[model samples]
Target: MRRFYSYLIYKLYTWALNGSGYNTPIFNVIVTLACVHSFQLIFLMFIAFKCLPANTHLSGWLNYVAILAILFLISHYYVFYNKERWEGYVKEFENETPKQSLKGKIYVLSYLIGSTIGVIWLMYFMSVYLFK
Candidate 1:
């Protein structure tokens, strides 16, 4: 079960990161929205809430938090550790004849802008929500 779950997560991450149509404007939007930090934050939040204790002052949540954190790291490590496989998928799915048109450039530019915003937001979220 754990192996299956890990495999599923890895595949999902690869798909989100290297979308089926990565060069397409819509797919780029999806990739921008599905950034790693966003998903990590969501998962950690869910685990924290689910493991929160009834006695608000209790520190029991720490154990669960730590365990979940390890699992989270493991899942991400698995995905990234298999970088060669992911790159192969990207190479396979990427456009055979790379787009050189103005529209293609615009799409790439939009993706870069959107990705920048997403990274900034993730940093802010970590500092504000996770740290303090």
Candidate 2:
């Protein structure tokens, strides 16, 4: 079981990082989203079996997980194949825009705040489910 799980995880990591294109925002975004999608699946599956055991037999959850997996795979492949176009687009945008460190800092701060909220919400729900 441990070997199977490890092999599955290895395949997933290979899939997530299998782009042939150079490092760019498009590649980074797709990989990051794929990782987030993978994390979400792990979280939900753990919750389903450990917390909400009643829904363990439902096919809908499997369907939902499949959809998410497909979505991320498509997104990653799309970006990987069209990397040149994406790079050109990014270059054009960057050439037209001026650097604004303050704005960039603010955006980073906002993202951190949103991520904190999401983590807190997940913890709260997990606590409720596990304790109740």
Candidate 3:
């Protein structure tokens, strides 16, 4: 459990840093805004779900799917942009030899998968609220 929390924190830090970049303070501000937006959405979804009426299972599931789709779309846009920056960073780091290692490939793959999961989770919560 401790390790999981550590990993989660690391991932969140990476997400913020990668999304915003370290070039300027504006990136940090953007990261903060993004975090706020994400958290607010989650909270709203939770409240919405809690207030949902009974016997709305089908509606709730549909809401979940729609929420997931929307979250995926939005997160994908941000993730892609962040990935471009990451690739640029990689290119800069390998300027001399221009080599791609297995670790690098794995890292990128994991980043994409993890981000997708995060978006999906967000959508699921929203759906529960929306449908309820």
Query: For each candidate, what is the lDDT?
Result: 0.50, 0.52, 0.50
RMSD list, candidates in order:
10.8, 11.7, 11.6
- For residues 8-127, write the lDDT of model 1, one tens digit per residue: 333344445555555543333334334544555654565455456657644686787678656765564444454355455445434534443345445545544655665567656766
* Winning model by TM-score: 2
Number of the predicted model whose lDDT against the real structure is largest:
2
Cα lDDT of model 2 by residue, 1-132, tens digit: 543323333333343446565445444555654555456556566566666567546767778778877886787566445545544433433432235534543554454454455656775787787556
At residue 95, candidate 3 shows an lDDT of: 36
User: What lDDT is reached at residue 21 by model 1?
Assistant: 52
Off by over 4 Å in 1: 1-39, 42-58, 96-132
Which stretches of candidate 2 lie above 4 Å from their native place?
A: 1-26, 37-56, 59-71, 79-81, 95-102, 105-117, 124-126, 129-131
TM-score of each: 0.34, 0.41, 0.30
Q: Per-residue lDDT for 1-132 in model 3, tens only?
A: 544323333334444556643654334433543554455565565566566665754655767757875775567447434534543443444432224334544554465455556656766865676554
Cα error, residue 55 of model 2, in Å, equals: 5.2
Give lDDT: candidate 3, residue 91: 41
